[model samples]
Target chain A: MIGIAAPLGYAAYLSFFQDRMIGGNVFVGFDNYRRALGDELFRAGLWRVLLFLLVQVPVMLGLALVAALAVDSGRLRKPGLFRIGIFVPYAVPAVVASLMWGYLYGDRFGLVGQIGDLLHVDMPDFLGSSWMLASIGNVVTWEYVGYNMLILYAALRTVPHELYEAAEMDGAGEFRKAWSIKLPAVRSALVLATVFSIIGTFQLFNEPNVMQSLAPGVISTSYTPNMYAYNLAFNGQQFNYSAAVAVVLGGVTAIVAYAVQIRSMRKEQGK
Target chain B: MSVNTPARRRPRRASNALTIAMGLMLLYALLPLIWLFMSSTKDSASLTSGFGLWFGHGFHLFDNIGDVLSYDDGIYLRWFGNTLLYAVVGAGGAAFLSTAAGYGLAKYRFRGRTALSAVVLGAIAIPGTALAVPTYLLFSKVGIVDTPWAVLLPSLVSPFGVYLMRVYAAEAVPDSMLEAARIDGSGEVRTFFTISLRLLAPGFVTVLLFALVATWNNYFLPLIVLSNPKWFPLTVGLNQWNSLATGAAGSGATTTNFYPLVITGSLLAIVPLVVAFLFLQRFWQSGLAAGSVKE
Candidate 1:
């Protein structure tokens, strides 16, 4: 409990105060929160992550669902190999994944550049200002898609085979069986993964931070809210403001994750 | 046998299509690792000049590994050792605590069980990085900043691991077993350590590996907490090398690019994990179901 609560509680406590050179960490009483709410960098980072969540989560989870359904349908050969092959990336640390993708995303010396030159085709700079969001999305999607697939796949395996036979007797084809039977079975798993992804999206730090070097100007210190708060405390020495940003980010993440949880619970009950 | 009728025959053909599609997903997943492996074989120059997807000029993988190990007074080896220490100790402690707490939560009657479980579940949703700055502040106040404890303390608690253990313990450890142990004069703590823990072994290893992956991959906590290079884990140390290379490219710094070393180091970092996954994935499948299998 100390591990879970102390820092967060301290963070909440620290958020209300600002350090002044004259007075030395005086209680500012909502000033920092006001500033954090109005801060352009934090707001932009917030919106950017929202955009990333919208574009990336569905694509990644949708693909995971498809992969899980395909394997669970008992149609795939070497399902074990297929399953583990996909999950191998999840085992790769986010920092390593970012560095790997950062190297691959490099325009001058990266794989795409070399491939483009070999094919006589111009490759757009993947880690450029406009593309960095999607580039980071690609890295995150690669890492978690298989992990989520495993979760859904686990749920699928637990589903009674009797359910499938019943669906078959009802004349359901593969698609219909998946829709009517397999999908409902994994509904809770899907929500769990979605909530995890929601939390992950809000905590987007490693990818953009590690990739910042490769795309210096393209990826800023405030590329994500977590990164923004990081830069504030570590780089700018604004611990109070940073604490406020973090608390707000944590609050926002909890709200969304809680909402997803509640909605999934309601759906389960409604069924 | 009844299901293996003519109706299943059509889906067999459709299964062929599913096999091909899953094959693509496997390729998509494996491509980057393939790229990482192939890239590690090349020296810095060939990395850019040679084919990106295939073997680059001379196979300098061993040579690059040597360079990565020997560079800057063999700091990569230090970082590797540090990573191993952090992962082993941090993940090991987290697994034990999570299992103990989860077992207690599962078996023993306690006040506010619902509230405690809800809090644990709620804690899982909080983004870890969001706690970094505040954690730094808290640790600094206690003068633990820049120490291993700063990294280890935060990593030692995983709410998800606890949740996994709770669910697994509920299913894996029968209440009757506990009662039998108690009747046999085993105290609660002794009973847990002796009987319940043995039954929860698979779940224990599962959470252990999960915590292992988590601490191994952890970046933000250590980034804020540890300023000294000696304490830096592999992730932070590798990024430092990467930045040295990227920093040089970005500006006219005298930072000579450590491109080969960084790539080789990255390849080296993930090797243990990939091996672990390959070996444990079948066993790990049982653990994944523990969550969904819960009431």
Candidate 2:
């Protein structure tokens, strides 16, 4: 109880006060929040992450769903090997993954540079401003698809063998069975994965933060809300404002995730 | 017999198309690790001059590993040791607390069980930033900000672990078994430790692995709390090396060849967790089935 409530309350309390140069710390009421609302970089970062969440979550979850279904279908040879192989990335820390991908994305010295030179074609800059978000999305997807796949596949394992037998008896092919029987059976697991992905997307710090060195101009201090809060507190020393940004970001994430959970629960009930 | 044979044969026959698709996915996942391994074997000069997907002229893996271990007064080894200590203590504490709290919530007739579970579930949605900033402030006030306790304490409170254990315990530990233990005059705590815990082994290991990975992979909390290089985990330490290698931390730092060390360090960092995942796959799958699918 103290673990969750105390810190949140403290942050909320701290958000109401601001530290000043001459007057020391002062109670600023809603001034910090107003400032965060008007901050262009904060808003831009918020919008960027919202965009990231929309595109990345679905792509990652879709890939995870497909991978899970493929493995669970018993149509893939050495499914265990494939499953474990895919899951190995989840064990790799985000810092390491970002460094590895950052190096690979290096056009001058990395894999793409060599490949472009070999093929005599100009390679797209993976770390450029135009492609940075997508590149990060790809890294996030790579790191998580297997983890989500494990959840869906585990859920699939619980579906009785008799369900598939019954479906087969009705002359339903693999696709038909997957579409009707398997999908519904794993719906809750899918929802769980979706919620987790949504949370993960909002907390997208490690990749961009680690890669910031490689692409200095592309990623700003306010590239994501978490990054913004981090830089505000650590770099800018605006603890009050950082707290407000964090509270606002956390509030939005909680509301969206709660809405998803409630909507899914209602849909399950309506069925 | 004919119908059964066709039905069985159909599902068992591996589809060439599916195999190909899965193989592609496998490649997508493994290629980066392959690249990391391949790049780790190259010296700093060869890393940039040579192709990333293949090896360099010489087998320099040991040389790079040696540099990583011996560089900068062997700070990489210090970081590794710090990471091991943090992960072991943080994850071990988290698993134990989750097990005990989850068992209580599951087995006992508590006053606010519904409310408690709801709060725990809701806690999962609370962003790390929400907790981290305030926790840092509070810890600083208490003067534990730079200590390992700052990271360890926060990590021990895994709301998801509690939820998983609650769900697992509800199904795994039978009421009849508890009643029999009670009838035999065993204390509630003793029965829990002796009987229920044995039944919860798979679920415990599952939670342990989850907490283990979370702690080992944690960057944000430690980043905020610990300022001492002596206390930095592999994630932060490796990123520091990366920043230095890329010249992002500004000039005037020694440790000239950090690129190979970073790559080699990254490779070494993931080895233990990968091995753990391979060995504990079955427990994780079954434990998750009980926790998630049953719910």
Candidate 3:
């Protein structure tokens, strides 16, 4: 009960001060929601995060799948070494990863710069406005690809060998067997990874937040919805408005994630 | 089943290609970490100009370590200590709570077990970052903001850990054994602590590792709740230094030396996680292998 008490009690107390926090003389029920909906930056932040969702999620998951497939095929002689090496980045704290990448993305003293000089072609400034999102996306993809690979690989191992044997008997090659048997078997795990990726997408904070300091010209205070909410509450001191934004962002995530779950569940049930 | 000789010969060629491709992919994954290790040894000037894959001037490594240790009155050491405290206490508490909840859900036919399990499943889908704002609001209202308790308390509720324990407990602990414990005049708590918990050792270790890593790498939540530098974990502290490094880089100050410190600090921060992974790798492998057999 104490587990429940701490959070619930805190939320209740915060709820009581919504009027004072917002600076509205009139008591407004869900007016903060109205304000949040009307906020341009909030909408832009949402769109930016959605854009990230569209691009990065698929790439990250695809990389993970390919890595998992490669590692799981028993073709890799040193599977344990490869697995540990791949998963090592996931264990690196996000802040450190961002810093390391931030340096790499630096124009003057970065590795890319040195390489660019050697090649006699200017490397794109990763922290610049045009490429910042892609730069952060690269870091995120690098960090998580292996983590998701481990999950999918673990799921892939659960697939029975008899299915592959049967496929082999049918004169199916490795690609055909993977497509016809392995992929379908790990479909649920893939869906789980997708849903996790989506939820994680919305909460993209650390990479961009840390990067903002590294490259302030590129990252805005409202780079992502979470960053927007953090700035609104902490910097702007508009706690009520921040809470409203947070609630809405949480709602969007929940609704989308729930829809994905239900749709996947229904698909599984139909199968 | 005997393979046909002609077709079997073709499969070997394809598998060889696949093996080479997999090896390359593993190399690609490890390249950045290798880069980090190499770069950490170099001076700032060499870090930019020298071969990125090779070491340059090992003098700066000791210098960087000393600088990192001495920075802002040795706050890095404080952050390290606080992180250890957080990981130990938070991971320990999370494991205990998760075990108790998981055991209850797995063994006892409670009224709301299904509902509780469903809630936990739903909670697993909700990212920890989503809950950060709500948790911050909740913590602030109770006047625990900027305190270690704010960070520690929230770290205790890992829904995934609970879910994992529940699933593992269901299979690993036999009901017959619990019945036997009951027959031997042991209390439920005694049975749980002695018999069931012992049986759940592998599961416990798995949960502990998960909780420890999650809490150790937890940057966003601490960033939100704690403004006090004293309470900042290594992630937050390092980020602050990175921000300061960015400012100094802009001004072209003598503090350019701090870049080495950040690199070395990052390298040091990675050690504990590597140690944890190494320590737990055997257990994780065996646990997953065991899981594979049952499935």
Candidate 4:
């Protein structure tokens, strides 16, 4: 508790003050917050990640939901092969996964480049500015889709056999059974995956950071809020302001996550 | 029951279309891994020339592994050993602490249980990277920068792990069992260690693996705390090698064509984790579902 609390408390304290060149770490209350709130790059970075979440979360979770349904449907042959296949990527570190995909995304000697030349076709640059966001999203989705599937599938497995038998005896087909039973049983898992995705999207650092080397100038120093704070502290040496960004981001994440929890809880209760 | 026909006895199953869709999902997941394995086999020249899915002219997988392991005074092996130490100590310690704390919260009603639970829940939602800079500030102020404790200390606290153990403890460990142990003149600590810990194995291993992966994949935390490459985990080290491979010259860069090394090194890094996931799938399957207990 001390380990987690002390730093957060320190960050809250630090967020209120600003370090100045001439003033020698003078306490300037609310100045840091004012600057961070109005900072365009920070806002842009947050918006970009929000956009990422909007697109990536559904695609990833939808695929996970489908995979969970298929595996739990009891007709898939060699389910282990599919289960392990989808789940294998979850084990790859984000750093390593990003690196592998970065290489694959490369246009020079990467697989895309090799294929493009072999067929003499023009290929859109994946690391280009327009596509970089989605490219990172793809890497993240690939890494986590299976892990989320397992979570949902685990939940699906817990749906009582009695419920299925009741549905089956009513002459419900497979799709009808899934529609009425499996989806409802795993509602909590879906919500959990959503909350996790929200957190992960806001904390987007590793994928973009790793690919920054590959894309060079395409990935600015402030591509995400976390990256922005990182740059503020390390490159710009604005630790006080960086602490402000951290606090603000943390506050936003907590509120949003809490909102998600409340909404899901209400929905579940209403059901 | 005797009137039921054989046609009606067969269970309804998923359609062929769903199975095909699942197969495609499997394909999408496996393509990059397949590419990675194929990339590792080729030497630097053949890596660029051949197709990514198939093996190249020379099977340089062993040679590449040897070089990756031996390059720069065998620093890859050093990083591997460092990752092992951090994963074992950090993850092992985290699992123990979380188990003890969670069990305490579940079995015994302490004065600050509500407050601690609130803090734990808040911590779970807090973005860890958000604390990175402040943590560096605190660590630097306390003069613990560039030390393993900087990473290990933070990794010791796992809110999710605690939550999982609390759920598993409540579900798996019966209060009557503890009552019997107490009647046998067992101390609370002794009874917990002897009785509740075994019942908590699945959750413990799940927490251990989570911590292990977090520490192993840690980049931003270590990147800020430690400036020395000597203490770099494979994630940071391979990244350093990656930037060195980016055709950026004059920063003491390695050869620009060291993609083979990077590819092979990445392959090496994920092998242990993949194996761990494969072996522990059953535990993690249940462990993940255990999270829904609170929900």
TM-score winner among the candidates?
2
Q: What is candidate 3's DockQ?
A: 0.47
| Clashing residue pairs in candidate 2 (N, C-alpha, C atoms within 3 angstroms) | none
Report the lDDT tens digits of candidate 3 across residue range A135-238.
Answer: 98999998898878877787888777666666677788878878988887778778878888899899899999988887787789999999998898888887
Cα deviation at A119, candidate 2, in Å, is: 4.4
Candidate 1 regions off by >4 Å?
A117-120, B1-14, B248-251, B254-257
For each prediction in turn, the share of the native Cα contacts (below 8 Å between chains A and B) that it retains comes to 0.77, 0.76, 0.43, 0.68
Best by DockQ: 2
**What is the per-residue lDDT of model 1 for residues B14-115, given as tens digits with 9 covering 90 to 100?**
367778878988988998889888888988778777766789878999998999989989888998888898999999999999999998888888899988
Q: lDDT tens string, model 1, A87-112?
A: 88999989999988888878645787
Off by over 4 Å in 2: B1-3, B6-11, B252-256
Cα lDDT for residue B153, candidate 4? 87
Tens digit of per-residue lDDT, candidate 4, span A1-271: 8888888889989888777768788788999989999999999999999899889999999999989888887778777788889988887888899999998989645787777878999878999999999999999999999989888888888877767666666777778988989888888878888998999889999999999989977999999999999999998999999999998998888788889989989987897
- Per-residue lDDT tens digits for candidate 2, residues B1-295, read 1235443325477789999988999999999999999988988788878888999989999998998899889998899988998899999999999999999999999799999999999899999987778888899999999988998898889999999999999989999999999999999989988999999999999999999999999999999999999999999999998888888888856443778888999999999999998888888878877877766
Runs in model 3 lying further than 4 Å from the true structure: A1-26, B1-16, B248-254, B286-295
DockQ for each model: 0.65, 0.69, 0.47, 0.61
Ten contiguous residues with the weakest lDDT in model 1 chain B: B5-14
lDDT of each: 0.86, 0.89, 0.80, 0.86
Summed over model 4, clashes come to 0
| Interface RMSD, Å, model 3 | 4.0
